[model samples]
Target: MNMPRPLIPQVMTTPPTAFPARIRGPLLKLCLGAGTLGLALHVFAADPAPVPPATTTPAATATAGAAATPAAPKAGAQFDWSKVPPVTAPSRPGMFVIAPSGPGYYSLWDVVTGNERKAPPVSPNAPYALMTNPAFEIDYRYMEKPGYEPDLFDPIKRIHMGEDFLLSFGGSFWYRYMRESDARLTNTSDNYHLIRSRFHADFWYQDKVRIFAEFLDARSFGQALAPAATDVNRTDMLNLFADIKLANIKDGPAYLRVGRQELLYGSQRLISTLDWVNTRRTFQGVKAFWRTPTFDLDAFWVRPMITERNQFDNWDTKQEFFGLWGTYKPMKGHLVDMYFLSLDDNRHRALGRNGILGDSITHTLGGRLAGDYNQFLYELEGMYQFGQYSNQDISAFAVASGAGYHFKGAPMNPQAWLRYDFASGDNNANDGRRNTFNQLFPFGNYYLGWIDRVGRQNIHDFNAQINLHPQPWATFTAQYHRFYLANKQDFLYNAAGAATLRDATGQAGSYVGDEIDFRFNIHVDRHQDILVGYSKLFAGNFLKATAPGVSPDLFYVQYNMRF
Candidate 1:
């Protein structure tokens, strides 16, 4: 029963969701763009403008009025943090705000200091303050009936206060609503709605340590329009977690403190917790980070939070997960990573846990490497899994690998990826298959392209994509996907009929099938933006053989903004 959602008959027919209350699109965009432009100009035209000399000696000043401008700093040197100015309080005229008291020591003009100037004072009057503004945004989407496909477009708004102690400590707020056009064949068109909202905040104790947290909520309406469709309007517990980090360590390199946090490895093709769905991937755990001259290493362990929906059916069962990941950048733009991960499944028996009665224990070992060359980014990864056989003696293995290339010029970056997946299971064995893509994590949901050639379960997928950044604040992306059965011989003509493997050879063989998706994102302002998108899906002869008319088509769009 643990199958990919797309493979589930119910999900395939389910319509996509829609956004919340509509808003003025054009006016909203104009306001946001103008705000960003104005802020940029202000930063460039501040009073007492600090302008350094164009050249070191200026070929001996053309006129006596010229002062010896300081030499330009080297390009690849570390940024100086000492020159930061001090903060002042309105109530106490002579008092300085937020004096240095925490982990990392504070200094002004450190970002660009030379032997001549020891360091700048940490005062607002010095130069610039380490601060940020917070913002929020929202979007709503919808579609029509019949095909139950999607037509997505919505509205959004966002805002942010300057990054002062109060604003920074309060975090940020965001809300999004999407009405999907697809739902299973229950004929529940326009009946599914999803509302997501989150409140985030961060607290810094001293300069070296910080605490971050977010409260997320998501609700779904299956068929609120129909009194009989109670199944359509259920609320979901998406995400609720907190995490902290300790940046400067007095004795050790650095100690990373984590509670409930999200982690992403290399390209994420083999290991991702899809956050785009609104639920966002999360795990309750802790981790430590060690940084040395050659590399940085992270190690952590976690367990399910056991929210209402994800609670284990059997409370008596015990489950635990742990992992160790490390990254080494021998040179700039080159990163290599290796990890050992383990997850215990108390819900199902391991493949070979017991001798005669023993089931198999699921285990995965994987590693990846990525590099940036000029404007091109590339990723290479591989993973191997071993454990349990549904019906046979001990013997099962799974392997996965992925590669991608990104084009540089323009915002429309072109990229492609190839993935090969193979695992052990009877052509028809039904063991516990892990859902690698369903997790609620932004790192998991983001893809280089727009196809799920590997739409969950035990299927092989090949995918590719192109990203176009035509407008300065907007991006358009497209993707294609193809699917195939792990083994062709185990296919059957009909589930109801008693036809054996031999009689099913007459069915069409597994082959070409693909899905295309297009998406556009526009930045309305520094704090807000809008998104629009659509997709078309098709299945070739290969999918037709597995089940008649199994492939379905769709289109969707949504707009979002922050205030």
Candidate 2:
């Protein structure tokens, strides 16, 4: 057996508690900002100006990059694979059905944020009319439509059952070359290749019942260090679930799904599919949801599926996860989301000053408000957690806020946004109370700078982002981030939510550093995309005081194709 190398960032076991004195001020400001965001949206929605039809923006997972189809594309569908509430996807696109808000794994960025940089291109790779229009890789309902052209793969994509049954196929390939200099300020460098591929089969019966199964194979090669758990999960089940209609709603049907699957929630700050990793994340459980034009609701309970290289994976019986989420669209281009998420884990064992410890249980309650009004947009989310870990009390909080402006017709179709994020940290290690916020499961790569030197724990980030669509087939993004420790005495967390460096005393200073990142995306045609990115981090006083103080640079090129 190969020893597992440390992944870039894994969820932290240190539960956070307390309301730090330093974060209180910013907390108040963020609270006010959230309220203002809601009010402003209300005003815009109430405006007497003639309301325009809901704009259909390219959601994060909207397919693009294929050669333009000679035939005009069909009207795109709004159905997605996310069980959570996402901000994009047309508000009232036909009758609602069981669709993902936006499958976190299928999208490059946070689909919940409506942040896709370019309009999707028409699909030309599929011969069947069912796949003529590009859709997120997870959506298979299109196959139910009766249509076909002579093609080997087309038959596998749509096989008719006796009467109402239909079977479909879906899959994709993602590859990347990763290289870094002075990673973690260790004054070391390495280059490696990562490859992750997936295939799935979807079977449906009269749109009332279904079975979906997906398989994954991920690998890493030519690395100086052993591959992390995230890099290898050879021949494993990614998703295997059964769905049954519970009731029929206006535009769709409510569903109760059971088995192994993935979970994604609003903003994906706490619960996500963890798609950035080679193997990604999944769980064995059940989920129930109903999607409609006016509102959406979901509930679920599950155990995280453990990934094992060269072995059959199974659910970790020691943990339990459950959540409830609801989204309301009060007016066009605006939405509100509320959720409650909790986890119970028996994984951590430690000795207190006294005896053996107990299990860890944590709960998170939060809400988000977001909207797009006349090229101005904003998103705000806040979460507070209280629980028990190893007999210690836990209390923690996190907030993320962003405001941006979109230039629809300006040069380069540019968009600029300013964002701020904060998470609490524990002041004393042995204080019996933890304040460092556990990130849970998240798409940390997108929230923090891509250099991945930091995480959404014990940190404060002031960042700015600019996105540009320079051509029909290309997009560019640039970002600058300034980071500081929420509590100078807390540990400095890596993007994986693990504490790699710390200053027990408050003397090292809170300044973590600055990071600049740039990325370019190009679409060869519908099934292929190429991405190039570079990131540089400037060492701050905190590192100089605690470690080597060496800054790091990272570069990567990625390719993705779906079939």
Question: In terms of lDDT, which candidate is strongest?
Answer: 2
- State the C-alpha lDDT per candidate: 0.35, 0.65
Cα lDDT tens digits for candidate 2, 1-563: 23232211122221223223333343344345435543443344342332223332222233322221122212352322222111123221101011112212223322434544333322323211011111223333233233412333456665655555667777878899999888656877879999988888877776577877787889998877678778899987787777788875553357877777777666667776666678877877767776655556677667787878988687786776777776677666677778777777777652222454667777788988877788787888889998776757788999988888877666666778888999998786566876778888876767788877799999999999887766544567788999999999988998777778888778999999999998877655446677889999888999878776588999999887777
Native-to-model Cα distance after best TM-score fit, residue 44 in candidate 2, in Å: 21
* TM-score result, candidate 2: 0.77
> Which ten residues in a row are the worst by lDDT in model 1?
86-95
Give the runs in model 2 whose Cα sits over 4 Å from its true position: 1-59, 63-137, 140-155, 349-358
Taking the tens digit of each residue's C-alpha lDDT, what string does model 1 give over 1-563? 22111111321232222211111232243235434533433343332222221111000111111112212322442422111111111110000111112222122122124212222111111111101111110111011012221211111111112222111321222333333332221223443444445455444333244455555554455534542211121232222232234443321244544455544443444333333444444455555654433344556545544434432111112444555555554554455666555444444443321222322233456666655456444555555554333233333344444444555442333444444444332342333342221111112113322222233323455666555545323445566656554455333221111222221353565553566666655433323334555554465666554444444433334333222
Best by TM-score: 2
